[model samples]
Target: MPRRFWGIRRLLRMPVTEAGDQYSIWVGLIYIFNLIVGTGALTLPAAFARAGWGLSTISLVFLAFMSFMNATYVIETMACANAVYKWKRIQSIKRDSVQDHDDHESDEPSRPFNDMEEPLVCGASIPSRYYSLDRRVELGEMANLFLNKTGRTMFYCTLCVYLYGDLSIYSAAVAKSVMDVVCSTIPANMTNVTDWDALPCFNSSSADPEAYTRMGCYRVALVTFAAAIGPFVFFNVQKTKYLQLFTTGMRWLAFTIMISIAIHLLIGSGAQSRPPAFDITGTPTLFGACVYSFMCHHSLPGLISPIRGKSRLGLHIALDYALISVFYLLLAFTGAFAFAHLNDLYTLNFIPTDNDNLFVKIIEYFLTLFPVFTLSTSYPIIAITLRNNLQSLFLDMTRLESYNFFLRKLLFPVVAVAPPLIVTYFLEDIGILIEFTGSYAGTGIQYLIPTFLVLCARRYCTTLLGLGVVNQYKSPFSNIAWAVFVLLWSFICVVLVSVNIIQKKS
Candidate 1:
């Protein structure tokens, strides 16, 4: 029993260390590659088709958006660093006050939630457990802590948004890809000659409808078991090391594969075809998928952090943003041009269904494999968040040390899996889920959080100018301008989420 307990402790307490430089670069590259190859490439053609936009126009617009998101990451990282400093200062002030109290006074600080031992509202008033500076130093010393906890906390929170966004986008593409493959296998004459509504597969009311059953089952299995679990487990076990290796591979692979995909797409092939001008439903789904694809900015901080001295992280972030923008623009243009009118909003379906076309088959296979990888990568992030939340609640409420081990191991996984699974059952379509989740939840976390954090930090900048709170800076106009831009984007996201939900309900 003692040995088993020690083994569990070892598993949970594994420390994450920085990877070597070469591997770290690869990790960043792979992270970007996943964004480009995973689903974005598959979906862009369809999305542009629905938009009725020219290839050039679509390329330009997407590139501009990518650039903006990358820039936002720079601002956010700066804000997070500042927040850590502010939090430390606040802690210092509290400590100083406690130390200066009269000798006769009780050592305990006054509890804000309670007065003279009388409970204000509840059955038992909980006493606050604010830590002293000595305790803070001890905790910091215990871990090989370099980055402040506050910054780490923010980084992890952003990581959750990234993983969830990936899941939502990849799942949608997988569903569409499955449908395309199954439809291709069927005889055209049978589909046409039969009374379409009366056919078992086509009839919406059938016991096991083809579109809803076969494709849907495969999607759910891949998403729940493969994409969610695979990455989650890998990251939990390996963390930064896994990131380093993956990023390094991705950087070179992204440049090579992106060029190849572009060339193949430009020269017409069996898998590629032009899509229709406007399918309201299809266009929205495509847009949703694309938005989620761009949510890769969360990892920008990790990329920048390793570089020593003077805002190098910001420069790296800016460079990555520019590179990603170019990649997306090329993808959107080539894909749109390849499939002129027959564009399916989901890009995975654009690949040729034939088993013989090597490039097409390779891409198709990767599309199939992506869900498993995405889910696996995402699981660790969910576990970490769940563990943190549970720990916070336990410390605040129960204050019991005896059950900490059991709670950390047994409860965390259950909490992590249950909610997403239950939500998955109600959401039949991956496109809708991606659209709704990205526009509402992912957008706020990705765009708004960074902007807000940046604004908070910039408030203290010594160069003062202008009338209102927003306009008081050396770069007053730029600050206010960016703030307004973020606000507008956030508003649009809210509207998109609401409209999607309503459409789904109807």
Candidate 2:
């Protein structure tokens, strides 16, 4: 065999997981599906209406492909990080062996879930390397390993911004959904209401006129939401198995109700509705919404870390994307055809009408409040993730033990949860939040960061582990040109989104 193929053959002999390192593959898939299909999916129908069906379909398909490719890049870099760590460990063991003058030290077998089948002898020829994905290496730690000081700073900044945007969108959506559902006097018949703010929270309020506006209700709802969900950030909470199951169940129920109802409406009279084929002006917001809809790169590590077997991880993720993409298409198409005017949040389209049957009305309320249920479950987890990252960015891990509990635990969570909530206080528009978050910071998280990590990891791994080592989990799109392409795509998206925002204002 040629020298180039030798490492791959050796690497193929190892197992992807050990006996007790992670959970079953099915659970991992559920968590990923839940994370990827959240508030972003809720906004897709409105984006679809604005951009038109044909153009939206093409853009969505392409964006999903790019998102999946970036996901693979992150996975590949995780394996590289593992490889680097393992190599350093082995070298440390070798030096220790020399100091102790023990010949038997180098003869020990490699541990499971570590680098597989590493050379046992000191001063021997470097063998082909195979990095396992059994252990979880986070994107931040990967950045520390593969990126310089400036690169690490930029990575954390981009990640923090995207996560803050995520929390902001979640906060605003949940509050708006709750306020809309709970307020009876906000006009049940929304046909004549051009602006959401035009409706008053109550029929009559002479005590304080400003307090009667919908904006006041929204602020109250926002505060109530914060009071209810904010405490979860201060504690350590994991997404347990039952929580995943429950979230998945609620998500499916909500989607079924929305799609079935829309289909029924379309069959009756909505078939005559004519939507635009293509609208260039709407494409900028559409681009942002599509990118937002497919965002899972930032949370991939935690979700992918617990899978028991990962030899076919890429295949499994592809299937998840396929299912999600199909479901998104169904929801968007049904919605765009079923209603002449779509709400920014698609769930709001299902608000109960006065004439609705009792059972139908209950279902309508449930669908309308779907964002609250789904986003409520997610907000704490994202807040906690951001809090931990903030600590990593600010606190020195070497002196972590010296810090008091208040500074270490309480401050970061408050820091993470406060900014976005404050942001909601000033701006409650979900469309603007999604557009800026998904288009700018989201572009960096999804495209540029992953590209840079993989490129750096590949270089660092090759230098450390020798040229013959191979990473089994390497992305199929492994060419340097792919990295270049992703970078170029990110640049172009940022430029276009910025230009569109400017034109809209002018």
Candidate 3:
């Protein structure tokens, strides 16, 4: 085995061999689907309404295409990292054991997910080294290996900031959703539900309607959200297969219900017959929203690495992304025409808190509070990710193991969870915050990092494995052209968003 094979393994502290566990293609796709289609989708209709149906659709489709392209790059980069191992052990290791392991995993049931474990070593003395489908390479590790300290620092900061924003958005959305539905009961008159910014309705009976405002309820929910989910940040969250399945099921049901209701409303008199054809002012927000909505970049490694079988892996990812694109298109478009004024969170459209129909009221409550069902399951996982990144940023890697475990763990969770909760208290609006978060940090992570990762990996492979070696896991857009374009696009979006923010303030 070549010394280069052990280079990334030592640097990232990852196992050089497989754990004999891999996810089926369907499971992989489902993970990708569930991650992308969350609170982000809830804002699509409003984005479409402002950006215009046509522009919003085009932007979303374009962004989805970009996201998919970047996903391939991430996949290719992971393979390249594994390729270092492959290159190191290529001379000494043989293929018989690897083939047998693949065959064994193929025969296993696909219903329940498999746990990641140490690589199963069998026949060969040096162990079979191959960059097969189930190889795991986390993004942070990739940044460290392929990038300079400066580059790695940039990545860590961008990722942590975006994730903090993400947690904040999730916290606020669930709290607000619960507050909206719980506070507003069946109003005496449902004929005139306006899109006015009203404070939380706090009056119990007819005594004092102005006693409590919506903001006040949101404050309470925000505190409760922190209390319930904030603690999960301190612990390590592994694959909760059942919890994920439960959340994924509820997500599909809620989304399907929203879409069904939207279509029905559009077909009826509730349709916005003359929504703008092209809303130029709305394009920036739409861009941010779409990027936010399509974001699975930070989590792509987790989704792709554990999947079994790599026969035409690129096509599988492409197909998965295409399906998601169509799904988002259908969802955003339906929501656009269904109502005259859509909430930034499209779920709000379905929650007719004061509707006359009993069935409608039931659904309103269901859709309104649906985030609690889904985001609650995800909050801890994301917070943990953010927490880990903060650890990476602050502590020296060499000294990490020697650091005080209690302080190291406790400090990050508090740093990660507390600030976001505090920020959300003052900055109550989810829409504006999501814009800055996605337009800046989201763009860099989803677009810029993948490009650089691939470039660096390519350079590393060419230097180590030589130009003659073929990287089987290479991206279709594996050229400098795509990478350059992504970099430019990311920079342009950031500038545009900044300018827009300034103008709005002025």
* Top-scoring candidate (lDDT): 2
Task: Estimate TM-scores for all models.
Answer: 0.57, 0.83, 0.77
The segments of candidate 1 whose C-alpha lies over 4 angstroms from its true place after superposition are 1-41, 52-220, 223-240, 243-290, 297-310, 341-347, 350-364, 367-403, 407-410, 422-428, 457-478, 492-506
The lDDT, on a scale of 0 to 1, for candidate 1 is 0.44
TM-score of 3: 0.77
lDDT of 1 at 186: 39
Root-mean-square deviation (CA) per prediction: 12.8, 6.1, 9.4
Candidate of highest TM-score: 2
- lDDT by residue for model 3 over 1-506, one digit each (tens)? 22223343342344433545555767667766667777777777787888787887778878888888998898888888777655555433324434544666545333211121223222333222334434455677678778998999898888887888888888888887777776755345532324212433644554544447566677888899888767666765435445667778888788788888788887776677456879898876677677777888777765566666666777877787788778787888887887777777777666564468898787777887788877886777677667665665666543567889775777888988888888888767766777778788888889988999889988987787555555567788977888888888888788767876776688
Where in model 2 is the C-alpha error above 4 Å? 1-21, 102-117, 120-130, 185-200, 204-220, 231-240, 395-410, 425-433
- lDDT by residue for model 1 (1-506), tens: 22212322332232222333323443444444444334444456556665555533453455446435534534443333333333344445445544644434554444452342322122323321111111111111111122346654654454444445444444444444454444334345545423332234322575656545544544555455544343443223235446434544544454345446657766646435555445455444454545655654443333333332222433454465566666655666565655545444433333456578797677665544443344344334434443443344334322335567656456655554445444443453555555545666566555665555455434432222112212111222244676777778667656655665676678
Residue 416 local lDDT, model 1: 48
Candidate 2 vs candidate 3: the lDDT winner is 2
RMSD of 2: 6.1
